[model samples]
Target: MASKIFHPIFFILLIFIPLAPIGHAKRSSPSDKNSSPFNFIKKLKGCQKGNSTKDIHELKAYLEKFGYFSYENNAHAMDDDFDDTLESAIKTYQKNYNIKPSGIVDDETISKTTTPRCGVPDIANSINYMQPRDNNHESSSSNIHTVSHYSFFPRSPKWPSSKTYLTYRFISNVPTYARAPVARAFQKWYSVTQFSFEQVPTNQNSDLVIGFYRRDHRDGFPFDGPGGVLAHSFAPTNGRFHYDAEERWSVGSVPGSYDLETLALHEIGHLLGLEHSRVNEAIMFPTFSAGQVKNLHPDDIQGIRALYNQ
Candidate 1:
């Protein structure tokens, strides 16, 4: 197989950037009828680069929390002015979610802003994983030939080759009902990858740990109640996965409740070093809706295989 190369422009990402609080979501579907974490954004819609509103500061903070705003921009994040920096960040965010890069708070941008998403930033450490990558190689095994939307954390971290089989355990405080759905999520991943998973006793240290917590759990990355962030996990070798206990989570399709298995698959992808995919159908897509059940897309398969050289 020919060695595949990603374009240099696609690989650059900042490191050690601080994370701010991302926006929240509506309690229900995309119908635009419920409480939103970013309801303030709706009022600021149509505002652009020279416009200023007291709510603009909230918008600035929203962008900063999700890895769109830069450190230098913090000086202006507290102010109500919509400056050039805020416009730039909005453009980047718009481009990320496939909204037009108008740099204005348009209806489409507002809709995305209010959607429930993972706590992990779409552009973690300054790497906008939502950007598409050119995949020109013909896999000798699968013979896939096409562009890909899958991406990785900064430096593409992963589990060591020697540790093909991993043991995972739920924290003692995790809800009893969440275990089965989460376990099923692990089974789905094992079917696609060159790895196997085993559930171990909580008393034993395992390769991965899963838990649920409410606001400010002290993990550096805090949960933002019922709607905003569903869950988040670290890149490989960290193995800490957390779900927001405040969410209305269920094992199957239920109105106003997030499907546990679907989100578990997503966070597990992060645990395995896969970043958010721009392809909306892919489970790795940054935002997920309530009562939604998503399966692994081909882009997800291609990405993981490419990452581990499978």
Candidate 2:
């Protein structure tokens, strides 16, 4: 949306270009110092101590997406110099993710940002209309637009018990390995809620639809091809879960591999209508690692149970 200097981040390929292919199949971590976007960012300067650059704009957009920055000023945040707002946002992001609160966009911070995360906003306030919007939910505080804790979109939506015995269908065309974690992800949520998910073939209509897509696959929020976002799901009753087919998705704890199960678990929370959590230990937390395995945190359980009356 701007010049080459101000194009959205990720447009820059590393000068050395040792990073893996960009796709949901994988999102590199800081450990991949030799080839990650973080490594590229770490080599730069002027992104700290109230100094900004074009990269800072990208970072600002990222922070807004994950709930660190406000949605109010999202339209005009393209400053080439870092400001107090960016510093504070970086600190909050670091604190939530357990990074040292340095207020700098260091290698670790950029690496984590590049990690696969749900394409959904940390909290919605009528900004993303890719799916249905509910405006009935009240705000916890007027000052804060979005918080990191497990929250509800507008009205704290939930599936009724009549729909408890839900059915889902995986995009039949993807590799079989994708099925393992997708199925397990549904079961994981089933263990805690009144809901029980059954898989139906794509030919038949299902309550939930799961599939892989790449770039602007027509649901409004487009996948940026590789590292920036992993997958996204619409809020409950909407029942749409989409993964970036471009990602190098893995089924298990493969180092340097993006865990489909971990991501599926997080996205399912969204399908069930739960928001991102402030608790770093919570499955609903906004950020995750390449090989992370997380069970439902109390906050996650409470949020879902509260919505479902379980």
Candidate 3:
């Protein structure tokens, strides 16, 4: 499992200057929001000028993360010079990110690469967007049930009764804080279900395994660059939840932050055989924003109940 190489230029910029100012200050700048497709290729070409031998591992890692690799017998190749291979990779990355696949890096692509992977913009103090709307009745359209109805329901399997356990393993190392929210997330899932799920001892065989790594984990899905995608998972067959450790994960109630616990809950849902929900209010929705909590909203309950009725 290698990470995808979507926006290599943006990532390199971040590393060289962590606090460097954005070139454009106004929100309306054309380049501020769009990024050209050839940005990474151009950068790679520039870097190659100074150093003849370049490490394609970084680019290879990026491609693997976003579910794009050689399909023919699982064999893949990386081009030393930004050639046809690079062009194809760019198009694939653009398609996944919802950008135009013109094969020319533009400003909009850059914006998407830099913005936080998930979460809505905070407009509390700004006079631009209006305040949040309120409805007397629970938002029916926002209801999770609206989306759960269409998920692929998995047959209930016999799970451990007393000692059902989940484990989180990092390929190299993970921050202590990172593991904490994931544990809390697992607990949140356990609270709503009849099955009692708990964290097993560090070295014990586990019912579910949660893995965190940069690139090339056991399963196929690899990680993309830092901001493009947060993480992905394998369904019930493996019960593996892998998060990109490179991401700046948030774990608490914040006005404009990505809650780690919330993400874990969503990924865990996938592990349990739940698919992305069409309902915006559902936690299982494919895209999430800041201020969205990870708890099982009523709709999630309805969907889970559909799977296991007690």
Candidate 4:
């Protein structure tokens, strides 16, 4: 039930302003173009190329960092050719970065590959615009769950059955540090609801697949440079959770670190049919300030209870 006032409108407005002009601008001719800045990084040449015939563990490792492959080794057959794997990896990279999904190595793909992952710029400015002016709620803990006007419509469907348990899966291709916080995120919901949940390794039969990536992966919600929206999730039928690969997700009990657990908890709340909460105290608030999601408030509990009650 975190405050739902933090709508995507704020972020959309910022992106639209800068991008509108670029979309309408005339394209530069190839002949008029000078030396390309991305000409040098046209291939995966910096790292030692693994044996093309052997299983390319190193190549997989490299691609996984950018959310290309699922971390679960068994999800993909080991016998698959490294070249083919690399092709898929390249394609996902292209999709996230807004390039065409050709699955072929090209100059544009190389250029984007080398660029660092970060959220959208002007995030601070956008947050300021959307948030209240001269608000002094930081010191007051009692108002955390107070409902406000910005909440969206609750989208919960009828419960399948009281006996029908809900399941969630977090499938990550990033490193261990990135995937570790997911457990605590699930726990956030279990803390308030009567439902039982567990994290399953990515497999062919898994009900939900949570994949993380930076820019483009498979779905159309291409991640902007690190700071824009932290991540996005598909609706119920397509339960896919994708993270912006550019984020250095924090996973511990620290003050300033970005809590991966907290973020995932919020997103999963979305997955569970909850929309953004009008109450700032709820964990489902659309935007998060640093170190703000240590716990869930009563509004979140109320929403979940309403959904699960048959």
TM-score of each: 0.85, 0.73, 0.51, 0.48
Q: Please report, as a residue range, the 10-residue window in candidate 1 with the lowest summed lDDT.
A: 5-14
lDDT of 2 by residue, 249-308 (tens): 566666555777788898999999887765678888766666567777766887787777
A best-first ranking of the candidates according to their TM-score comes to: 1, 2, 3, 4
Clashing pairs in 1: 24-37
Off by over 4 Å in 1: 1-35, 71-73, 133-145
RMSD of each: 9.9, 12.1, 14.8, 18.9
Q: What lDDT tens digits, residue by residue, belong to model 4 across residues 230-277?
A: 666644445666666544445544333346667777766656655554
Model 4, clash count?
20
By summed lDDT, the worst window of 10 consecutive residues in model 3 runs over: 7-16
Task: Compare candidates 1 and 2 on TM-score and give the better one.
Answer: 1
Whole-model lDDT, candidate 1?
0.78
Candidate topping lDDT: 1
TM value for model 1? 0.85
The list of candidate 2 runs beyond 4 A from truth reads 1-46, 70-76, 98-102, 106-111, 126-149
Query: Taking the tens digit of each residue's C-alpha lDDT, what string does model 1 give over 1-310?
Result: 3222221111122232211112242233436335556677889979998887878888888888889966575567688888888888999888888889999999999889988899888886776777754532333446745567888988889998776787898888775567777887887787788777888888999999998887898989887666788899999999999988767777666666788889999999999989888788999998987778888888788888888888
- Write down the TM-score for model 4: 0.48
Which RMSD does model 2 reach against the true structure? 12.1
